[model samples]
Structures are given as structure tokens and as C-alpha cells.
Target chain A: MIRMSNISWRFLSVWRRNLIVYRKIWKVNFLVPLLEPAFYILAFGLGFQGLVQGLSYGGKALAYTQFMAPALIAISIMYNSFFETTYASFVRMYYQKTFDGMMTTPLSLEEIILAEIVWGATKATAAAAVMTLVLGLFGFVNFPQGLLIVPLAFLGGLAFGAVGMFFTGITPSIDMFNLPIFLFITPMFLFSGTFFPVSGLPEWAQTAALIFPLYHLVELSRACCLGLVETNPLLSLGYLIVFTLCFLVLGLTTMRRRLIK
Target chain B: MDQQPTAAGEIILQVDNLGKHYNGVSAVAGISFAVRAGECFGLLGPNGAGKTSAIRMIYGFAPPSSGSLRVFSLDVADDWRRIRSRVGVCQQDNTLDPDLSVLQNLLIFAGYFQIPADQARERAEELLHFFALEKKREAKVGELSGGLARRLTLARALINDPELIILDEPTTGLDPQSRHLLWEKLHALRARGKTFILTTHYMEEAAQLCDRLVIMDHGRILIEGAPTGLIEAHVGSSIIEVSGADQELVDFLAERKVEFDRMADRLVIYNKGNAEIEQAVRAGFHSRQCTFRSATLEDVFLRLTGRELRE
Candidate 1:
């Protein structure tokens, strides 16, 4: 078993360094993700609210803007996690060869993987936090459980970040990343009950949606924001925790094989 | 003076018949060598000669397809972490973060080794001063010149005061002055009893900096010795260069008793000094320039590996 405290300390160091590196390129890096979510919030949430009728989720009448706001925040977290972990990890692994430099030191492959996941999660959290504040300012979301949103957004980030690293381990070139993002991630973002509920879908599609960890994350976020806590919040949390552990293990193992051989 | 107890002439690293294959072809095949404590051993090979592949195995970047590697008497398969902590490597490429400043790059690498932040900063400062990069401490790595970037990489490798430092083509793209500066720094470090394993295609660099080296080609060691010893063993005592020779001079020398090869327009006489060749050239031929010099590592390389260009 790996020591959590030792790994946490190492993760924090790598996370802080990644943040500093991003801050230097913040003019380009921050603007892209920040503007993307804001555009989605404005165009899809606020712009389409009047056109679409109200929907009933868990016996509560909610407008499209209010219904989509929480999921949008969750989506932001996923995008941030995925983007940060995959592209940045690729650059560090191949182009910059920064991981090669680190592996030459006392840092183990486990520590490096943990550090990358933590950094991705942190970026996801920061993006989600900013989007949450922006949504609050626009009065699009009235989240009663504001405190829960932050940690849940972070968990959502962790889930996607771990999966991103798993892909990073297998990516042979930068171009291969496009397939996973377009084929897998786009479908997950669209069909995971984000824009619409999965209640009326076919049984196979619904079952497949359930296989996506993001769907549960979106559900958990929506429940917390709408203050509709259920008896089985633990189930969704357990699902997310399990997903995180599986992806983390897979990413660490693959990275070990790629790096340490 | 905190004088530490040092190992007395102990072999710290060993590789036995190491081999690595990519796809169906072998990149490094059945090559073997050992590095003693505090010795600067060089792997002298041209491009595609598998120098990087061998170094990668030594640093645990990749497992050898066959053979064994031991560091500090510990097998690499079992003690990779311990071995990594004790070794520092500077790869052929510039691996520093382009967005990070020079000092920040070193500090981040230090953190990888789990050095505390304050101590990391202290070490970065000392390294910057030592490398003459203190003035550019806050400059982003992308803005630094190639020489400064290379120096910073060297500094980053020294952050942990590693026992064994591996430099793969450390001076590849630098100017002559920068190359000399880096060589001087490496020599100084060696004087302080740090072991270094370097690989380079530059024969002059191998001769100047490496205490002993092995000549490698086609993924195998062709010969191994001190630079002077290899030259003596391969190319004999001296070289004579005779220029401005006409076809008549070439024909006469070819028919007469002389061992030489035509390098461009100049006839280079092997295994003999200028005085003997000068007498021969004056007696039977004419030349505008005739000079003699002792054999160099370059001559040894050309003699053993032919003058044909390797793709």
C-alpha cells in the first residue's frame, strides 16, 4: 500500500508547480477555458430558457437555465480535468520530456501519476469555482448547497482527470487525442443527462449512460444544487469514489510501464 | 571541512551484455561496461549508434531486452528507486519548462527529489551563481540563449548533488566558448569526486573530457581505452599532411614505398612523422605545404571506422 501522506505532499508540490507554470501562460490558457464555459452559460442556459418550457425533475418545477446551470458547472469541471490532464501530461511526457527529468530523481511513477491527477483536479476545481461565481452573478443558478458544490465539483474533476491520464498513457501521438475527445468525451458530455434527462431513452442507452461516471456526477451536483437530497446520495458518492480509484490505478500502472519499463 | 568517508576504488555501476530491441531490430546489442566510483566514462558514438538507448537502460528509463545492470551492488530491477535518487541525468533535449523562469525550473526539479522549498531555493541560487546564470534567474527559459539553457539543464541535474551524473551529448549545440565553459565546470565537478557518464559524437570532446571511453558503432563497442591509448593502438605514432600534390606526385607516392590515404587534395601519410614524409616528398615529388602532427582521436576514429559518412 502506498502512503497517503507521502503521496499527498508530493502531489501538492507538483500541483503548485503546475499552477505556477500555468499562471505564466495564463493569458492564453485561462482565457480559453474561462471563455468556453461562460459562452455555454450565456448561449445555452440563458438564451434558450425562454424558448423551452419548464421541466419537472424530482417534483420541482425548473426552467431550462436553472436545470442546466448545475450540469454546466459539472461539465466545466469535467472539461477542465480532461483538458489539463491529457494535453499537459502529453507535453510533459513527450515534448518537454519533463517527466523523464523527474523520473531520474527520487520521485516514483506513483508519485508522478498522483501529482498529475491532483494538478488536473486543482485546475478543474478552480475553473468550476470561477464558473459558479459567474453563474451566481448572472442570477442563473440559485444553489442552496453552495458548500457541497465545491467538493462535488472537485470529485467530478478527479474522476475525469484520472481517466484522462489513462488515455495519456496510451496515446502514441498528439493527433490520437482527438479521437478520444470527439468519440468518447463528446458523447459522454451530450448523453450523460446534461442537456436533457435520460429517463425516456431506450433501456440499452440508459444502461450505457449509467456506465458513464459523469452521469452520476451530474445527478449528484443537480441534487445538491436543487436541494433535493435523496436517501442514496451515498450510492452516487460510492460510484464516483470507485471510478476514481479504478482510473487512478489504471493510470498509475500504465504510466509505470511507459516510464519505468 | 566536513570531510566524508569515501569509497576506495569501488565499482559503483556494472552492465553485463545489455541489449535493447525496438520492433525487430536491435538498437543496443550485447554491449557491456562498468563505471568505477568517481570515474568519468564516456560512450563515444555517432548518431544512431545507440548511446541514448544504453543510457536510458542505465537510468531505468527502459528495461533491457536482455542482460543485467547493477548499481551500488543492487540489481536495477529491485532497487530502481534507490538508484534513481543517487543518479542525475541531462538528456540530449532541453526538457526545462518553457514558461518557467530559469531559477523556477531548477526549484521545481528539486521539489521532484522532495527537497523542501526553502532548501530548493537555496540550492537553485547556488547553482545559478556557479553556472553564471544568476543574472538571468527571473528570465523565462524560452527567452534564454541556447548556452544558458544548456547551463541551466546542467544545474538542474546537480540539484541533489548526485553520486553519478549522466550527461548525454551535454555540449551538442553550444558554441566553442560555451562548450569550453561547460567542460571546465564538468572537470571541476569531477575533481570534487563526482562520477560522470557522458556520451558524445564529438571525438575532440571525448578526448578532452573523458578519462576513459569506449568507441561504439552499430550498437556495439568497437574499442575501449583512454583516448591516447586508443589513438596509439589504432593510428600509430604520428600523421603527415602533404598538400598541393599534382597527379605526378600522387602517382610517384603511390608507386614508391609510402603508406598514405588521400584526404581531399592532401595526402595524409599514416604511421610516420613529417620529417620522413618531407624527405620522401622532396626526393620524388613536390608539394606547397607539408606538416606533421601527433595522432588524434579523430584519426583513430577514421582509421577504425573508415571515412565513409554514416547516414
Candidate 2:
């Protein structure tokens, strides 16, 4: 019997515990979302801009780097939330046994997973904001409208965190995580309008990209960051919200089934 | 005997025909027990005998498939959150956060119960010293030795000032000294009216610490009573175990009408007194050690569960 109402304020305790632990290892974790992706931004920004210095390939865009940077920020948020909820949550659940420790102290399994998602989203939210700030410093961002992308990135993070938790909940072994990372996350990173516009891909590839949650996240983040949303941004935001809520329910149930027994 | 707690207004915990199954296979099959307000109760069993399952149910981690389990008179299914704040469970696995310092583990665990920061700090200091890990307070959990980690875990369970402490195989892998120290700490806590519910296969531990315990096997309780009462009722006052014996010893026992169980290569003869074993050992039959001693809980455990390897 998994109920959404089974969650309560105790989720905050788990969230706070992670915060305390994160404080101790902030040098490692904080840098991954902050500095680790800068190399990607620089390498791709400098390397690819030379080819499309004066032209746009997706039929409508200012410059290629300007077109790709917002997607990169969104993708960065997704990866941070994904890895946070997957390997990091796995370590807490299995290796460090912090999950078991928390369970004995009146925290239910549902509350714990909820907290993991919240914490993962928190980390990704920070990464999204920081990267947006970095993009602003580099003059790649478009002022007040660009600032709006930070919150959309946060919403995308919440959705990806839930997705990460779902995979982590069903994983039978540690090595099985590589399957999701390689199969799901890599494809999203490569094709979700991040490195290049999905419009450039084949018709079937674009259709496949629509099914990936990252694609909606990128659409929302890229539009908000560039002030170039053609349609109602709420459509993409609504998709992320629905996706997050669906997985929130599914993640809690799956993790509770796996953990409490 | 006067120090023994009598049945009071209500017991601390109760289980009635409790059962649990994993995918239709029973783990705890229709067993029941009670823990009083101020006494140490034990569940004694071999590995996979369902002691941990029972403990998990009481703590509300593993829900019962059938029957009722209650703690502090509150039903486990309904009032678990209310009951949980008053209870603490020290699980078999070392659930310590390895990335945190020894003191940090207690502090963070205390926060789970919403203990105030100052009070949690004070209790953390007190438990750190009580468990004799005060010196290692700043050391990370990964850096501590096995004994220290176990001690810290026990210390972490105390952070909430819980009334009922449930320990699962508390001394399973501890050295003799560590085991004794843990037993002493438990005794000291018991004296202060902190009720304990413990699970272990160590018969000696049950005899030493538990006021009353149940011996379980194959997912069911075989017997339950006070340590001495169970031994007296099950294994009797004395016993003799003779190995390397011939059929002559069997015939000799038969002539005296001595009831004994013949294992693969030995004879275990039970008695109402030590005289039977003493006289037999003095008679000098060709054998291994002829043991003569007043029975303890181990005798009762072995008699009920048998000496064969459960594995």
C-alpha cells in the first residue's frame, strides 16, 4: 500500500542530512555540475562555432553556439540530477547504508525517496542557476529573459531526478546502472536538441526525440534562455510537471516496494 | 527474583499469531511474544530462523502479512509513526554514514527524531562516552575499526532517548571483549528502565541478559520462558555427552533406564541430577570428554533446534 499521503515533513530531515553530507564533500560534488561541464561548453562552443560561424542549419537561429548553450544548461541540469539520484542515491541506499539508518528512525521509505528527489533537484537547481550565471558572464545569455531559464532548468531537474530515481529503484545490481546511463542518458544528451538541433535529424529521429523527457526539458530551457519560444512555453513546462508528478508517484512506490521489505 | 518485573498494567510490546511471508513463502509463521515495560526480552534462533523478520515487523519496516503486532499498546499498522518515535532499532547492517564523522552520525540521526540541536549534541556526547568512542568522535565512520563502528552504531540508536531499543544480532561478529562490553552497556541501560528487545543465536547471551526469551526455528517459536525455567523444563538439571562410545554404554544406559539421544557418533544423556553423569565418568568408559554440568539455555536451544547444521 503505497500512498502519496504517506509522505510528511520527515522528508526534510533526509534532505537536510544530505545537505550536511554534501557540505562535507562539496568540493567534489559542487564542482561536477559547476566546473566539470564548463569544459564541454568550451570545447563544443569553440570547436563547433567555427563551422557555423555565420550560418544557421536548423532553418532559424541567431548563431550555433547561442542556439546550443541553453540546451547545454538544461542537459547539464538533467545529468546532475540523474547522476545524483542514481549512483549517489545508490551509494546512500546500498554502500553507506544511510537509507537503512534513516528507516529505523521513523522515516518511511516513501519519505526517503521523496527526499532524495528533492535533494537531487536541489543540486541540479544550483547547477542550473550557476551555469546560467556563467553563461551571463560569458555574454551568451540574453538578460532578464535568460534569468527565467534557471527556474525552468530547476523544473527539468525535478523531472530528471524522478527519472533517475525510477531507474535506481528497479536496478538489480550496480552494473545495471550503466545500461541506463549508456542507453537512455547518452541518447538524450546526443539527440535532445542539446549538441545540435533535433530539427536537423531525420523525421523518425525527431519523433523518437519527442518521447524522451530530456527533449521537453531542452525545449523549455532553450526557449526561456533565448527569448525565442515560438509556442506557449507552458506546454513544455506542463509536460515536465506531468512527467515529474507521474514519476514521483511511481518512484516512491517502486522504492518503497524495494526498500521496506 | 525480587528484582524481576511482574506483569503490570500493560506490556511494552505484544504479538498475536503474527505471520509474514515473502512472495508466499513464510518467514515468520504464526508466532507470538510479549515484552514488558522494563525488562530485556530476547528472540533466540539460528541464521534465517526469522528473528530479524520479527524485529523488522515490530519496528514497522516489514509489515506483517497477518495477525497483530503492537508496540507501547499501539497497533503497528496504524500507529507506527507514533510508536516509532518511542522505539529505536539497531539493525544488523552497519548503517552508519561513512562519509560523516563518528559524532556526525549521531547528530544527523538525532535530527531524524527532530531532537533539538543542543539536546542532540548533549546526548551525542553522553552516548559517545557511554559507548567508549568519545576519543574517536571526530574520526570518519570509514576510518573506525569494526568494534568502534559497532559501538558507534549502538550509540546512534540511543540518540533519540528511546524507551524501547531493538537490537538485531548486536554482538554477532564482535570480539569477546567487545561483546562483554556491549552486554555490560545493555545491562546498565536496562537497570535505568530502558526496555530492550534483542535477537541473537548466542545461547549464552540469552542466558546472561534476557529475563525471558523465545527459541525459534523454521519460522516458528519452539519454546519460550525465563532462562533458568526453560533450561529446567527442557534440558533438566544436568547432562552428560559421551563420544567414542561403544554399544556397551548404550546397553549400560538401558539397564539403568537412562533416556538418551544417540547422535551420529555420541550419546547425550539427560538427568535430574549431576550424580548420574559423575558416576558414569568415574566408571571410566572409553570416550571423549564426559561432560557434567548444570544445564543452561544452550542445552535447551540445542535440544529444541537439534545439533545438525541448519545450513
Local accuracy by lDDT, each model:
0.81, 0.83
Q: For residues B1-311, what per-residue lDDT tens digits would candidate 1 score against the true structure?
A: 02232384688789899999988788998999888988899998767888999998888777789999998777776677677777889988888877688888999888777777788888888999999998999898889888999999999999877888999999998999999999999999999898889998788999998888998888899999999888877776788777866677677667756667787787777744536656776565543677668889988777767778888
The superposed Cα distance between candidate 1 and the true structure at residue B24, in angstroms, equals 3.3
- What tens-digit string does per-residue lDDT give for candidate 1 at A83-170? 8789988888888877777767766667778888888888888777777777777675555565577888888888999999999888
Each prediction's DockQ against the real complex: 0.64, 0.79
CA deviation > 4 Å runs, candidate 2: A53-60, B1-9, B274-277, B284-289
- Candidate 2 residue lDDT tens string, A8-78: 99899889988888887777866765675567668767887777655443355567667877777888888
How well does each candidate superpose onto the true structure, as a TM-score?
0.89, 0.95
DockQ of 2: 0.79
Off by over 4 Å in 1: A1-11, A23-46, A133-144, A202-204, A229-234, A253-261, B1-5, B243-259, B262-266, B272-278
